[model samples]
Target: MSIRITGLRGENRIGDGHNHKGRKVTSAPSSIGFYLYGALLLLVCALKIPALVRRPRDTLLRAACLLLLSAGLLMILAAPHSIAGLNRHSGIANVSAPVVYVMTTIFSGASLLLIINWRPAPAEQTRRLTRLCLVLYGAASLAIVLLFWAGDAPVEQRTLFDVHYAGTPCIREMIVLYLGAQGAAMTAASVMCWRWSAKVRGSLRAGLTILAVAYLLIVCFVVMRLCAVAARWTGHDLDFLVDEVSVLLSAPAAVLGALGFALPLAGPRLAETVRAIRQLRQLGPLWRALKDVPTPGAVRVPLSWWRNPPAVLLTGRKTALYDAILALTPHCDPEVRDAAHAAALRAGCGDADAARAAEAAMILVARERQRASPLRPPDATGREVRHAQAQDLITLSRAVTSPLVHHIRDPYMPLQKAANHE
Candidate 1:
C-alpha cells in the first residue's frame, strides 16, 4: 500500500472519458487478486498472533500485526462495491475518495513504521525517526480531508475519481499530496530493503529481496498513475495506464509483499523443527535405557513438552539424560571405566571414541546395578559425569547398545571388586 496509486486503485478502472483508449486488462487479477490477498493476510495474521500472545510487549510484532490489519481493511474499503455503498450511505457524489485515500495513507505509514522497527537501530534514534514519520503522514492525511471538502465534484465517478478530477482545483492537490506521501514511503522502504538484503543470508535475505522488488513495483505503479493523471491536464488520453497497466504491477506486488513478510519468520522455524525431530530419534535408545530410572530432583519433562519451542524439547531431552546419569554416579566404578577404555583402544577405536565407549560401558553397567540393588552402599563419591552434547549423545547412545558394553556387563569379565584395598 505504500505507493501512489497502487493503494488507490483497488477496484477502480478508467472512466468513459475521451482517453479510455487502451485495451482492457484480462480481469483475472480484478476477480481473483482480492480473494488471494485476503487469504494471505488472514494466514499471516494467524501466524503472528501466537507469538504476539506469548510476548505481548514485543513492539516489532505489534507493529507488524497492525500493518497487516490495516492493509486488509484498506483493500476492503477501496473495493468497488464498498465505495459505491459508502457513496450511497453518505448521499454524496464520490465520497469514497477521501476515505480511501486516508486509509491508503494509514497503510503506507504503518508499513514504514514496521520496517523501521524491524531493522537494528538505537532505541532513541528509532523512536525519533518513527515519530517524525507519524507527524508527516498525519499532516498529509489531514490535508487530504481538508482539500476534499474544498473541492466540488458533484459527478459520481466511482472508478475514475483521480482521472476525472485531475484538473479539479482542490481534488488535484489532494491526489498529489496523498500520492507523494505514499510514494515517498514506498521508495524509502525499497531502498532500505535493497541495501539490507546484502548483509543477510538464507531465508531472511531472500525475504528482504522479495520485499525490495515489491516496493519497487509499487513505486513504478505510482509513477505511471501520476503520469496518467497529469496527462489529463495536457488533454491527452493516457487513462489506459490506470485501467490496463495497474493490475499487472499491483497484483504481483501484493502477492510478493505478503510472501516476503511471511518467509523470514517461517523458514528458520521450519528448519529448527526438523532438527529437533532428528535429535529426538537419535537419542531414543539412551532415553529408553533411563526410562526405568526415577528422575533425580523430582523433575519430570511433560509428555506435551514437545509443544514448546524446539530448543525447549532439546534441552529437556538432554537434561533428562544427564539427570539420570548424575543419579547413577554413586554406582559408577572407575575401574570398570578404565578397563573398558583399554579394551576399546585395543579394538582400534580412536582416543575420543574410546572415551565415549568407556563412558557408555560404565552407564550400561550402572543402569543394571541401580535397578538390581537401588539401596546398595556407595563406593564411589563425587564422580564427575560430563553433560552430553548432541553428537556425543548420538555416539554414546549407539555405544551403549554395542556388543563392547554387553561384554563389560559380564560378572566374570575380570572386573575388580575393590581388591587390594588399603
Candidate 2:
C-alpha cells in the first residue's frame, strides 16, 4: 500500500515522499484555481438565493440554487488549505478524505437533480428515473463513508490524497464509489444537455451547449482520477493525471457550468433593458410634441430617482402618447388624412411610409385644433378610430418628425391663422 513515484527514466522508486526524483509536488496553483472557481459559484448562489426566497414554490430555481451552493461549499472544503485544516481540527488522521468524498458525491447527486428538474420528461417517467438516481447515489455515498471509516492512512496529502492512498485498505473502495457516482452524473448531464441544445434556440440553446461541454470536462476529470486509482493496482503510476491534468480540467468545468446555468435567466432581462432604451429614444420626438397638451392626472410625468431613466421614460411616453391620441380623436378629419396621404405619395414615399405619414399629419392637425378650442364634446358620428398598437405608434413616431409630414401639415396652418384673425 506504499505510494511510489514514477521517475523520468521509467523507473519505479520511493523517493522523498513529496517528490519524484527531486521534483517537489506543489498544490499552490491548483489551490488558487479552486478558490476562484469556488468564488464564482458562491456569487451565483448569492444571486439565486434571493430569487429562491421570493418564489419559495419555484422548484426549479430552488433546486438550482441548492446545486450551486453545495458545489461552492464542496470546492471550498476541497481546497488544499481547507483540507489540511479540516484534518487538523478533527483530530483524526485523513478525516478530510471521507468528508470531501461525501460532499463531492452529494454535489454530484444535486447536479443530476438540477438537470432533471430543468427539462423534465413525461411526468411519470421523469419521476421514476429521478427517484432511481437519488436512491442509487444515496447508496453510493453511504458506501463511500463506510469504506473511508474503515481505511487508515497516516500521511496527509490534501492535493493528491486519493492518488497517494489509492492502494491502501478501504481507500480504493472509497475512490471507486466517488468516481462511479460522479462519472454517472457527468455522463447523464452531458448527454441530456447536448441533445436538448440542438432542439432549442437563442440563449437557452447556447447555455445548454456550454453546459454539455462543461459536463464533458467533468467526465474527463472523473475518468482520469479513476484511471490513476486503477493504475495503482496494476503497479503503474498515473499520479500526474490525477494531480495535474484533472485540476486543469475541473476549474474550467465548474466555471462554464455556472455560466451556462446563469445565461438563460439573465439574457432575457438584458434584452428587455436594451429594448426599453431603444423605445425611449425612438419615442422622444413624438412624446415632446404632445407634452404641451394638458391631460388628466392619470397621465402625470413618471419622475423616479431610483429607476433607470430610459425604462421610466418608456412607460411615461407610452402613457402620454395614448392620452394625447384619445384627446385628439374628436378633432380628427378624414378629408385631411386623404389629402396628406396623396401629398406623401407625391413626395416619393412608399405605400407604408405614406400611410404612416398620413396618420402623423392628421394627428398634428388635430393637436392644433385641440389647442385652439379648450374643450370639445365627443362626436357621435365621428369615424371610429381603432386603438393604435405599439408598432403603429413607433411608425407614427418616425413619421412625425419627417420633412414630408411637416410639408403636409404646413398647408393646414393657414386655416388656424385665419381662425385666429377672426
Candidate 3:
C-alpha cells in the first residue's frame, strides 16, 4: 500500500521509497532540527532562571522569565517524537494531536505576555489586557481538549495527526480555535515590537527589531498551518506546508526570539567589560610609574597581575596612582618644572610633550625632595597642587620614561662628582 503525502502544490505517493514529485522528502533532518531548536530554547531558560531567582521582587522581569520558561518547556514537549511518545503512553487514540495544540496555544500566549511585560505598557491597561488574554487562551485550550475527545479517529495514523483529522467534526473547530489564537498573538507581537524598535537605540533597538522579525516568522508559520487545515476541508492536501515549511519557520523563530530577548540584558554588560579592559591598557604607563615610587597606601602587586589582570586589580592600580600623586603634591618645585620644560623643548619635544615632561620631572624631583627633607614646610607655590586628571597622568607617564626628562633630572650630578674627584 502507498502512503500519500501532500505538498503545498501537489500530492506525492510514496511506496518504494521514491518521490513522484521530483523531490525527496527528508523528515529525519527536520526531526533533528526540532531537537536542536528545543535544546537552544531550554538553554535560554536555564540562563534566565538564575536572574529571575535573584530578582524575585522585579515582577515584570519575573513574569517574562516564567513565560519564556513555559514556552520553552512546551516547545520541547511538542516535538514530533516526543509528542508521539506522549500519545503512546497515554493509551488514547491520537490524543497527542490536541495535547500538542494546547501546548502550542499556551506557548503563543506566553510569548505575547513576555513581550508585553518586557516593554512597558500602562499598568491598568496592561493588567486588563493580560487577564483577557489569559482567559481567552485558557478557554481555547479547554475547548481543544473537549473537541479532541468528541472527534472520531482518522483512517491513517500520522505524526501530524491534526492534518489527518482536520476535516473531522470537532477537531476542525479545535484547530481553528488554536491557530486563530496563535496567529492573533504573533501579529500583535510583531506590530508592537516593530513600533518600539524605532524608539530605542543601540542593542535594545537591534533586539527589538529581531524580535519583531521572529514574530513575523511565527505569523507565517501560523498562516501556513491554517492554510494546510483549510486545504483538508476543501478536499485538497497541503500537508507539506504544515509538516515541512512550518518547522523551517518555527526553528529560526524560536532561536531568534530567545537571542533577541537576551541581547538587551547581556549586550550592556559585555560592552562594559570591553571598556574596562581598554581603560586598563591606557592607564598602564601611569600606574607603573607610580608603582615604582612606592608611596604610602600604594596597592601591592597581585600575583596574577602579570599573568591575568582582574578587574579589581585594575581598579586598585588606578586608585594607587591617584593617591601617590596626591602624596607628592607638597614637594613639587616650580623651578624644577621650568628647567625641565626648557630642557624638553631643546630636546625637540612638541609643546604638549614638553608640558607633560615638565610635570613628570617635577613629580620625580618632588619625590626626591620629600625623601631628602621629610619635615620641610610645604612650598607656597605648591599649596594649590592637585592630583592630575587621567589624561594628564597618561601624558606625564610617557614623559617620565623619556631620555630628555631623565637627563634633566641628574644634569649637574655627573659634572660635579668628576670635578670633585679631579
Candidate 4:
C-alpha cells in the first residue's frame, strides 16, 4: 500500500520496489521519532508530577509543561502509519485522535503567538494563553461531539479534512470555526512563553530564550505547512520546499522542547556556580591584603611598639591585631580560620601569651561592629562575654577542621598555637 492524503485516493502514486516495496518494508523512521518524542514526553510528565502534586509556586508553568507534554505525545502517536491506520479503521470509533489533533494544533499555535507578541513580563500573557488553549480544546471537543451526532458516518470517518467539504454546511462551518480558534489560541500562548524569559537568570534564561525561539520556529513551521497545503491545492511548486523545510525545522523544535522542559533541574545548578564565583571575588581582595602584611617577628624590636605604635601605623587607637582579625572573620573558612587566628595573635601577641592575647583579641572583636575599629580592650565583665563568644566561634570552627589541621599552619610557636588558638 502507498501513502494517501486523508480521504483522497488518486492513481497508484507508486511504481517500483524502490518506491513501494522498499519503502513498505522499511517504513518511515516514525518509530525512532516516536521513541525520542515519547521519551521527552515521559520525562516532562515525570518532572510535572512533583509540580502537580506539590503545586509549585509557578502553577501556570507546571500546567503549560503538562500541555506541551501531551501535545508532544499526540504528535508522536500521529507519526506511525499503523497507529494512524488503526485510528481510521476502528469502528464505533472514539473521537480521541481528532481531539488530540485539534488540541496539539491549538497548543503549538498559541505557544508561537505568545512568543511573537511578547511584553516586558510574559507571566500574565502566558497564563492567559494557556487558559485560552485549554478553553479552545474544550470548545473543540464539544463541537466534535455535536458533529458526531449530526454526521453521515461514525466519528472516526468524519475527520476535519472530510468535514471541510462535506455537503452539510454546519459541519464544515464548525470545523473551520474550531480550527481558526485553535490556531489563534496557540499563537497567543507561544508569545507569552517567549516574553516570560526576561525574568529568568543565567542558564534558565538561556534555556527560556532558546525555547522562545523554538516555539516561534514551530509556529513558522505550521504556517508554512498551511500555506504549502493551500498552494498545492492551487497547483504551486512550494509544496516540496515546505515539506523539506518542515522536516529540518522539526528536529530542532523537538530537541529544544526536550532541553527547555528540563530547565528547572539545569537552571539552579547554573545559578549556584555563578553565586560561588561571586562569593570568591567578593572575598578575594581581603585575602590578598592579608598575604602581604609583614610578620611581627621580622620587624618589631621595640616592646613599646607592640604596646604602643605610632597613631599613623596604628590608624587611630586600634591595634594591628584588632584590624587583622576583623578583616579575616568574614572570609575565614574552616581550613583558614586557625591560620587567620594565629596570624592575628602573632601580629600582636606571642604564642606563650596566646590565651591572654586571644582574650584581648576577643575584647577588640566584640567592639568591632560598634566602633569603626578596635579601641582599648573592653571592661573585665564585657571581656568575659567577648572571650566566650569568640571561643565558641573559633572552637566550633577549629573542630570542623580537626581532621585536616595537620595541613594547617599554627600561629608561630606550633604546639601552644595549636592548643590555645581554639
Summarize candidate 1's per-residue lDDT along 74-130 as a digit string, tens digits. 776666556667888999877788988888888888888888889888999888988
Q: Rate the local accuracy (lDDT) of all candidates.
A: 0.75, 0.73, 0.68, 0.45
Best by lDDT: 1
- Could you tell me the TM-score of candidate 2? 0.81
Q: How do the residues 256-318 of candidate 4 rate in per-residue lDDT, one tens digit apiece?
A: 765765675577765665554454444343333333333333333333534543333323212
lDDT of 3: 0.68
TM-score for each candidate, following the candidate numbering: 0.72, 0.81, 0.76, 0.50
lDDT of 4 at 118: 35
Alpha carbon RMSD to native, model 3: 6.1
Superposed Cα deviation of residue 413, candidate 3 (Å): 10
Ordering by lDDT: 1, 2, 3, 4
Q: What does the lDDT read for residue 8 in candidate 1? A: 36
For residue 196, model 2's alpha carbon misses the true position, in angstroms, by 2.2
TM-score for model 3?
0.76
The C-alpha stretches of model 2 lying farther than 4 A from their native spots are: 1-18, 26-62, 231-237, 296-298, 308-313, 369-391, 414-422
Clashing pairs in 2: none
Assess candidate 2 and give its lDDT. 0.73
- For candidate 1, what is the lDDT? 0.75
Per-residue CA lDDT of candidate 2, range 201-264, in tens?
9888888888889888888888888888888888888878866677677557866986788788
